[model samples]
Target: MHTERSAAAADRHVGDVDLTHWRSRAGRRIAGAWAALGKRYGAMPLLLLTLAVGVGIAVLATWIASEVYDAVREADDVAVLDRPVLDWALTLRSPTGDRLVTWWTDIAGTIGMPIVALGFLVGFTVQRRAWTPLVLLVAASGGSLLMTIAGKDLIGRARPPLSDAVPPYESSPSFPSGHTLNATVIVGTIVYLLLLRQSRVVTRVWTIVVGTLFVLSVGASRVFLGHHWLTDVLAAWALGLAWLALVITAHRLYLTALHRGAEPEPGALGRS
Candidate 1:
């Protein structure tokens, strides 16, 4: 009877060991699957590549724009559309027209203010992170302002004559419009952030519509207020667009990295 009991005990011990081995093997397989998925679809590397290309394009556009601006300033009646464009921009001055133009500009400019507010709101509403979009927006605004100042200092292009009734506080070169650049940055970033958050198509459509109206109104206001030449507004629009592209590229990379469990890169906030 004692010999039989010993053999039964040995058999039970063997079965327990087998069960432990099988469970260990299954756990490793599960861990390997997760690692493989991460390796295949992470967004970090793509973000880095996009940022490099965007910065390159912005530099090229700014350089070419400066050269073209200088050439036009020196020539008499060059292939420039300064006066004609300005005239078109300013025709909305009949009593009713003035009201319409004023209303649009005010309304459009107001749309950008919420972005500043939204930056703070993000901390409460989304991630509870304060420094993210706020830092980016501030950086974009400062970069635009600095570029405007530098361009004005280098070119020193004159405004139209006294008959044109230049805008109050207008000074320096008529090459790039600062107001337009500011408008673009403020409106552009807001639209970008909103698109990322919203799921409904209608929300995205409204965001785009508001952003477009804001940018156009700000650029047009510069001409209407006689603060910038038509070319100035055009250049600012182009330059601002280029700046915005770089900013967006950087933001995309940051977001991609973020999605990939990486930290957001410095200088990806749109500063030069």
Candidate 2:
């Protein structure tokens, strides 16, 4: 009985070792295959990876936005808070506050946001002499505009009644707040570009803080001015963030590919 037990124990130990060894060998084979593919294809693999991730982000955003749209259409869940929030905003209104918010909000208006983005793009192009800022701005703005137009047209959500709105009332469909979405994308992209050039912790922190404040204030202004419901602004925030993530991810992947393909500088090797 003792001899039989020892034989069984040895067999179990041998099986465990063989399993681990097989796993190690399989892992090495997979790694070797990936390395060989990378060498042969250069940056194509990175580009393909970026494209896959971008598509996933877009699909996820679309799914979430659709859920919000359905809820709004059904007037349940988040849609229930719209009227209460709008009523609260109505109570806080004043001539001075309206004027101030209108002025600030206009800075992110359809016309205003494009102008601001263009000015920044030109300045960054001249300063950095690179097309990255332009690419980021265009991608961010274009995607934001497309999503805004599509959401508004598809949802066709009505804005607050004209009686409740501030002067110079908007006539467009107001499901996803265009002002809020544009502000988020443009401001976010600009901050991202700036951070790429900025190394100081304090400066980066301030940049992020200011950018966040600008986005929040714009979304709030839309509600306060009676141009959009709370849910519209919320949807715009989520959609804008999704688009921004896609842009940043693509940019990061591009940079990774560039760095991976570049040769080492003289005397730089082994220094790090």
Please list the C-alpha lDDT of all candidates, in the order they appear: 0.56, 0.71
- Which tens-of-lDDT digit does each residue in 13-65 have in candidate 1? 22123211224565446334422433454333443344445545655666677
RMSD of each: 17.1, 14.7
- Compared with the true structure, what per-residue lDDT tens digits does model 2 show for residues 243-264? 8877765654444333334222
Candidate 1 residue pairs that clash: none
- Candidate closest to the true structure, highest TM-score: 2
Best by lDDT: 2
Task: Supply the TM-score for candidate 1.
Answer: 0.64
In model 2, where do residues sit more than 4 Å from their true spots?
1-60, 262-272
